[model samples]
Target: MGILLLKLVVGLGNPGKEYERTRHNIGFMVVEELARRQGVVFRKMFWFPARQAKCRIGEHEVRLVLPTTYMNRSGKAVWGAMKKWRAEAADTVVIYDDVDLEFGGIRVRAKGSGGSHNGMKSVLEWLQTKAFPRVRVGIGPKPDGADMIGFVLGGFAEEELLKLEKVVERAADAVETIFSVGTERTMNEFNQLQIG
Candidate 1:
């Protein structure tokens, strides 16, 4: 719980105007909220494939990253930032959308396989380990017989959009809590609540 001591917080998503706020970009949304809370703005980093901002959360100075390498190749950006920060796989936290849970659900784990997430798969491949912590924001249930790709890439429905900010805020809060309280305590406090 307390051991995830992270230096980098990466949000996986495809970079482009059209992709903004889409279901898959919820990871981006969470990091953006974290940046806002720290009063920092993300700027293009030529040295790496991402927009980065430096911010202090609790006692730890963490780098918030939004990968510009697109979803599937997110590992490239994350790995680059990890190298820049001299961080290992365990010293990073990955936040991404998961279609397996209902919308508003969030799952935080210390370590696990990438599962069916291509972006996470790429991260695992590049990092050569599955020991990193991750925050999976729910984006799912995919609708009856709908195309998985279309559902994830699509924007939230009008109703869901109403509560989007709150969900993002909750996710960001969970992250800060991880830094402050510890992952286990934070998970115990946050895991069961479904935001409206």
Candidate 2:
């Protein structure tokens, strides 16, 4: 069969109002943007550790998910969603934050390692595969010798905050591109996006 179209889209982040605007929560921001565009709202699901929303993109029925498992153990919810929807690695796309790229930069990879993301580590662990598509929104540099946790959990700077909505909007556009076209094309078009 050809590449399986998107069935599940998961955004990794800690859950709660306080953590909503942190740099690390960009994944949540992007996916929430998608929900906003589609006019769908996320609701806590009983069968999984996630809040889920359903929407249509083209002819595909897509589910947008935010893990309620916080950041580190995000895999539990992603795996749960996959199982619930019978979606394989190829059919699911995981969106998350990355500290290596400069703030506002975005990267799309067809299949790859988890890198230094704790949330992605947990996802890779539970999914038992590296063959899933992922979108990484930059929140980076960590300011030399800074504590990684504090940096990531910190809120964006005032200037950064000003540009955040556009960044999230662009990333959401990238997700729709992934579904409308495919991962490789999305990567080709989005990987070079020079925001931040």
Candidate 3:
């Protein structure tokens, strides 16, 4: 059999204790869960805040990355990895939090517009394309008159926190399915999943 190509899975989030457990940092949480499942550890990289790991799921070789560039500047790290790995857009998957969807929900897209996500916007800007796959984790919309930034940066309330774990785990599973079965299959299987 020919050698398998390397796939890059990027989880976008800010790096710091202040942002930990925040709705916006759900990308980081999902990546952490992915690492934990694979028994891998994240280490700091000079070019970007990242943890690198090599793992095999079935017959495919995977490299998981968690960008430490925070949100707005996430593309820099993502592009860095893409170039380093020589991976194509089809082989890249980006996971991030989405304010447009309901809490504890997820949407997987094979390729589409960024839809006002700064982290995704950055990735598109750096890569110069929107052909990559993305898994969007819903954090829900802001309450009446609430500061959007504050809402995203703030951790989930006790009630929401209870449901967040299930969301994260599901996100990780969706990602694995994306790699194994392709984006279209993963989307069909995961998009209909409801969380309460």
Task: Per model, state how many residue pairs clash.
Answer: 0, 0, 1
With candidate 3 superimposed using the best TM-score fit, by how many Å does residue 115's alpha carbon deviate from the native? 1.2
Candidate 3 Cα RMSD (Å)? 1.3
Q: What would the per-residue lDDT of candidate 2 be over residues 109-175, giving only the tens digit for each residue? A: 9999999899999999999999999999998878989899999999998888888988899999988
Candidate 3 lDDT score at position 11:
89
Clashes of 1: 0
lDDT of 3 by residue, 1-196 (tens): 8687688889888888888889989988888888889888877777555667777665677888888777898888888887877888889989999999998888999899888888899999999988999999999877889989889989898989888889999999999898789999999999988788
Q: Can you write out model 1's per-residue Cα lDDT over 1-196, one digit (the tens) per residue?
A: 2443347999999899999979999999999999998899989999989999998786777999999999999999999999988887776889999999888998888889988999999999988888888899998889999998898899999989998998899998888888887777878888898986
Candidate number with greatest lDDT: 2
For candidate 3, list the clashing residue pairs, or say none. Answer: 14-70
**How would the candidate models be sorted by lDDT, starting from the highest?**
2, 1, 3
TM-score of 1: 0.95
lDDT of each: 0.89, 0.91, 0.87
Regions of candidate 2 where Cα sits further than 4 Å from its true position: 1-6
Candidates in order, TM-scores: namely 0.95, 0.96, 0.95
